[model samples]
Target: ASSSSPKMVKAIRVHELGGPEVLKWEDVDIGEPNEGQIRVRNKAIGLNFIDVYFRKGVYKASSFPFTPGMEAVGVVTAVGPGLTGRQVGDLVAYAGQPMGSYAEEQILPANKVVPVPSSVDPVVAASVLLKGMTAQFLLRRCFKVEPGHTILVHAAAGGVGSLLCQWANVLGATVIGTVSTKEKAAQAKEDGCHHVILYTEEDFVARVNELTSGNGVEVVYDSVGKDTFQGSLECLKLRGYMVSFGQSSGTPDPVPLSALAPKSLFLTRPTLMQYVVTRDELLEAAGEVFANIASGVLKVRVNHTYPLSEAAQAHADIESRKTSGSVVLVP
Candidate 1:
């Protein structure tokens, strides 16, 4: 393919940060891959809370009127010059930086993507790549969850949370999950959560204390920022790891060093990008995730999906806490 011309495509563009209305389905121009890049015609786009964060201005974007997406599965419609092992019609998926996957077609760095297993559906691949990789590093690398280690996951029924519960259970850990409603609690239990707490009606910290016989959890994965951050610390055992990966509710206040003195808590806020900074790291993480999906070790739930044009409604549903499992956008 030549890089002399640009192609017009339909995409979800956010001109200014605000509500879901800001996500407008409009036309945009995308150029051919210059070098070390491939043009992907997206089959399915992933919907994540991070997308919402970027859309709402909670996370800064480098430019305005930008497409909002980070995960997608598609085919290599065109490969850049001088690139080998990738050809037209190859199926692939990518997650993380250089974020622009909401369009019908996009130009991506060739190395950022990995081949999707033939057995996995493109929609499922799109649904799990980002969230599954997040779960991978969190359970296997971040704290190395082991048998007899009791871990608490907030928003247990979310895209990443569901994968965490299932993978942690497979790793022989006792998984305790917290959710807002009974329906989500059931889903969490079905996802292998040993215990499900409805935080809306009960004191999660107290429940966790009782479940662990007052010893507390080895690690607390808190995504619901302000509302659950402090309580997550309270639910940890001495020297426990407090992993705050997201702030779906809102960012928590700054922590005082004194906050960790009582439990000697180890607090870390990690992102998937930092965990997979190199090509080898990217392949390793993606390989593990795809292998798990292929072996049935991880079961992705694409419980909700919307047309790419209806991304606004999808965002509204997720932000209002009305959707569960994974949400994907069909192109």
Candidate 2:
């Protein structure tokens, strides 16, 4: 029996970009694992704002009618010929690139997926893998958060934001988070945020200033781009790092160099793809995330979930800021 034949699978496909309604669940054809690839039967899939970006054309898609997803946990059902270190029936997970995890099964490069510990639930791994890795690079690599270093995380109750608060707290940094409501503020505090500001109720920059005693934060992790970009700068200390990672509020207007002159602030926009380009880097990041999860140091809240077919609803929820922690899709 040749492994080159295509098999039909259920997937969420986008024929054109616009809104959440574009995510159409339909049958798609998936071929067998080619050389250096493996076929995975996804048990769980991750939902991310980036998925929303692709759906809305904020991030250009490779082609129309594409399946949009980047993270998932599943069992390997077929291995490419001559591939080693992988086999059918192995539990594995992957995030970032080759982007086709919205389907019931997908063909992935052999090296991209990592082994999932039996102790971690498939849903939990699917929920945290991408967000956890993003948190890993943002806190440990991007800014090197340290003890006594005050930091502000916008959308602190979000997937990556929650992980950032937890990891930063474990690293001994003073974690300050911004949320829209008291419920989210409380959740952020439980996740190790030292201070949670209700941005909807008050001026966050002033609150951050007061919280830091006018010293300001060492870094501001701002994901709510257009809404929080400039205020993030105001919340920074001298030579602070302003990491703009997302734009749920829409892309921020261009800023001139003068914007940083006052504080001499450093700005960066990083992606998980760049951080985990190599297999070793991927292993290290995913390994650390799982280790922390196993040790109870990083607690993930799988607060929202939807069937893969209901991805549109999930996207709608995330876009409206009605969801907190991690969101997953069962396939």
Candidate 3:
């Protein structure tokens, strides 16, 4: 029993998969890592709306009774085969796949974990990977925007919204963001949004036309799906791109491809994982973000942090559209 003893650790998991109340904090045994895995001693966990999708069953999972955090910054407590850069006590951060980050210790793939720069805070690393990568793909891959391009981004004060604003601004494009109220507009403007549309009061499509002198923007990054999809498409200039990255309001109904013809527009939906399928690719994508942060070209604003046990409350805050910017969970 001594040589084969099990170790116990704390984790947050859900039961019955309903609302926020289902996120139960409990003690569970931590076990040895499998091949090519490492046990991470988490310092911070990145909380995202995707976590809510898992909790709400919008994204199907293999089973229930799960721990839903997607990304974390941690120390490498132990490592198993094929890992060299990470060793005991090495500070590191990882994002994407095998979502069990809401814990004191959990096993994850060696390749999936990336080393955190000593200069950057662990919480920022935890917060940036997923959201930053999403922004990277949206700008670089989804539809490449050039200088002087005008764009509309929704929820522009939220996690990814802030990053997109900074990235677009640095690229010399005019960035327009929409929020539900004036407070978020200020936040978005503070995040580098050139123009902020208060959607609750203004007709955003009309506002987009107003901002562009009736020519419309070159693209619209719409995450507030159902409520804004049609109008988002209408906000584009001739041959503009519509990048629908998330479903904050709800998933919009399918669009007919022919609709793009009226304005000679383009549309595509992109996810981060698809953008970085290989280790070399993932690190390259991350390296751009790391360098941007280090150089001060990009700013990672973590607007909130909650204890891992209080994840349900975090999800509730996100669902309410009240909280702005990134939310992190410290385990």
Q: Which has the greatest lDDT?
A: 1
Q: Give per-residue CA lDDT, model 3, range 1-331, as digits (tens).
A: 2323576899988767688998899987767776787889999999888988888887776777788888899998887755676788988888888888999999888889888888788889998988888888888878887898998999899998989999999988999999987888888998889999889898989988888999988888988899999999988889888888889888899999898999888888877888989999889888888888999988998889898889889999999997888899998
Give TM per candidate: 0.99, 0.98, 0.96
Report, for every candidate in turn, its global Cα lDDT versus the true structure.
0.94, 0.93, 0.87
Residue 321, model 2, lDDT: 92
- How high is the lDDT of residue 259 in model 1? 97
Give each prediction's root-mean-square deviation over alpha carbons: 0.8, 0.9, 1.7
**lDDT tens digits by residue: candidate 2, 1-331:** 2575878899999999898999999999888888899999999999999999999999999888899999999999998888899989999999989889999999999899999998788999999999999999999998899998999999999999999999999999999999998999999999999999999998999999999889999999999999999899999999999999999899999999999998888999988899999999999999999999999999989999899999999999999999999999998
Error at 324, model 2, angstroms: 0.3
TM-score of 1: 0.99
Q: Write the per-residue lDDT of candidate 1 for residues 74-122, one digit (tens) a residue.
A: 9999888898989999999999988889999999999899999998989
Q: What would the C-alpha RMSD of candidate 3 be, to one decimal place?
A: 1.7
Question: Backbone clash tally for model 3?
Answer: 0
* Model 1 segments more than 4 A misplaced: none
